[model samples]
Target: MEVMDLGILSLVPAVIAIVLSFVTRNTVVSLALACLTGTLIAGQGLLGFPTLLKTSLGSTSFAWVMLLNTFIGIIVAFFQKTGAIQGFSQYIQDKKLSRKAVQLVAWFLGMFVYFSDSFSPLFVGTTMRSISDKAKVSREKLSYIADSGAAPVSVLVPITGWAAYLSSLAIGVGVIATQEDAMNLFIKAIPFNFYAVFTIIFVGLIAGGVIKDFGPMKKAEERAIKEGKVLRDGAEPLIGKELTEMEPYPGIKPRVFLNFLLPVMMIVVIAMGTYLTIKSAKTMEAFLFVLIFMGISMFVQGIPFKVIMNTLTDGVKGAVPAIIILALAYSINSLSKTMGTANYIISVSEGLLTPQLLPAIIFIISAIMAFSTGSSWGTFAICMPIALPLAFNLTGGDVTTLVVASFAAVAGGGVFGDHCSPLSDTTILASTGAAADHIDHVKTQIPYALICGGVALVGYLVLGFMSI
Candidate 1:
């Protein structure tokens, strides 16, 4: 198929899937259909049926990405089954921290985690939800903190997942001599990432109570409080009674709390230790070190081996949808590259837009792509090739501004779309994590994202006109 033909066909599946998801409220089904469509479009007689399956499953980046995510899920399950997360929540509650304080801590921790890993959203979010709830902070607010911190902080940090991806792309395009040089360039561009900086500030403002929830969020919070209902993680309501009427899990015995706390502390200590000791090691290496620590912690906690296996299995099962989505995203990306759909889009847009307007345009385009695809990293990977090349052309090879703008657009748009799209895995996870109604979370988060995105757009426009 021609580039335009492939691009047009791509739209069909996404549109159908989105419409079906909205109508049926079944994201898993919708995403599955979209994946199938994307795979078929990619194969397009280039390979036999068996080979197509093998190609999709064996794609290097996709496979490793899934493996990493699966590991994260296993860790999360371990945290949950061992009562570590709940114990941490209890510890925070016992401290009698104010709601505002807890929220601030959540934001801070999220920012901290983003420096080390893109999985900050899940790790920081799941760990902090119980604490935030104990303080009566709304789940919507918690989601905001997690989402704001994830991509924004990652892009700002030179050694994070965002930088790694962009560096690899730059090297592939021969724009940089090596991944190291590419990373250095990204590091220098950090100050120019206006969207990320402003978004973080916006999160702080919201958490500090300077910005109150408006629109659907305000309504939902009001409704939740007035009805006294418990919101579950993934945003579904338990319904039929006041939240207090719901049975609480058995109170954490001191021993159980100690078992949980000791292991978690060990993980943190070892992760930090590895980071400090390694000096020049990759983030993944540090993650592996922490994983080792986690293993030791598990042993120290005396959590049964069978229980650990079950928790790991449960975690992997939970990640299945995300894994599938990521695989499809990768396939679609490869298809677009081969078909030149990305280049076509870039060519069409480049003529109509200028360097001064590129950031804003890229931001908007990234958001649309992310919303359509329901994957932030996929959106980043897709747009980076087109946006970076355009940025370079516009600036006559001024690498810094172009790279900064491209990175900002990818991070900002990815978060914006992920924040509001009901089809997004993070959106679903946020709803599940908060125990709020899924639709309610989507409805509530949209206004917040719009307001922040508007601010970010203006920031980008102003910055785009300024020199480094």
Candidate 2:
């Protein structure tokens, strides 16, 4: 079969898998099926199945992707197992920190972890939930903070894994002179990232009590307090039980404040040191540096080697779904590129849409695709080829604005859909981290995402017209 033919047919299974996931509320099964279907379509025959799997696993890019996620998972798991996160939580609770202070602390903590977007939400949510609960803050609000901090901070930080990946894409398309140039452009574009900015502002407002609470979230907060429900789901009910069983590191004199303060300060110092030293290094080098820092930090925390191994293993297991989703998303994107589906989209749309409206169109299309597919990186991979070319064509080949606009579309639309889509890994993980109902997290975040998305749309339109 022709590549294009296979590409067209591949959409069927992907779409079906997405629909089934929504209906069944099972992300793992849905993503696996979608991946299997895409691989089959790419191969065009049952006999090619083994080769397809081998290709995906053997792909150097995919390996790096998985390694990055695995490392993040291991670090987070070590933090949790060593009582570091719980100690931090206890310190915050003991201080009787104001809700606003707690939220700001959480935000910065997430920002520090911006090197890995996949792990930011998990780290922030798990580390901060206890403090927020004690302070009577809503878990929905906590999700908002985590979601806002994850991708937005990663995109803005020039030394992050996200920046490297995005810069590589820009360089691949000749949109920038070098990876460093691309990173610089991305940094400059941060001020214009209205979704991220406004989302952070909104979180501050909610935390400060200026916004109070409204909508479904307001009701959830009221009920939680009234019913004495500290956690959201309250079905599995891990928070109280975990709290009761939690103890300081065995045989180590527990200075509650130091236990928390030491780990946090260490994380910040190591992260900054790693960033400065590895910013200019190759992807593998940067990743290795981060891995080493995480390992040493775990050892310094006095977490036993066997326990650290167990935690790391569990962390890797936790990332299994994310890894699968990313690989499949990459496969879908690869198949699309190989089959010229992206080029076809660009060619067909070029004459029909005005140059000034291309960014907006790309934003809308990306939003829809991400909402349906529930993977931001996948959406980015699939859209960048076509969108970047369109931006170049639209701007008469001025690469700077075109590159920024294309990235804006990817970042804005990717977050918009992922924030609201129940099937998104971040969405699920946010709920898991907060112990909130998954659907509730999705429902509460929709209005915030839409509001920011609306601002972004207007900003893109203004920029597009001015550039034209």
Best candidate (score: TM-score): 1
lDDT of 1 by residue, 1-468 (tens): 344445555565566566766666555566556556655666654333345446756876666656766666666665666566666777778888886788788888877666543456666666787677656666666666776677667767765456666667666443667877777666765766665777788878877778876786676456445654335334443111221122222342334444444544554555555544653324445445555565566656665566556555676776665565455445444444444544444545656567677788888777776766566677777777777777777667656665666666766776676566665655655554444444565666778778878888887787777743
lDDT of 2 by residue, 278-305 (tens): 6542434444555566567656767677
Candidate lDDT (C-alpha), each: 0.61, 0.63
Number of colliding residue pairs in each model: 14, 0
Top candidate by lDDT:
2
Q: How close is candidate 2 to the true structure, as a TM-score?
A: 0.76
Where does candidate 1 stray beyond 4 Å? Answer: 1-4, 36-54, 116-118, 171-181, 232-304, 314-344, 394-407, 410-440, 465-468
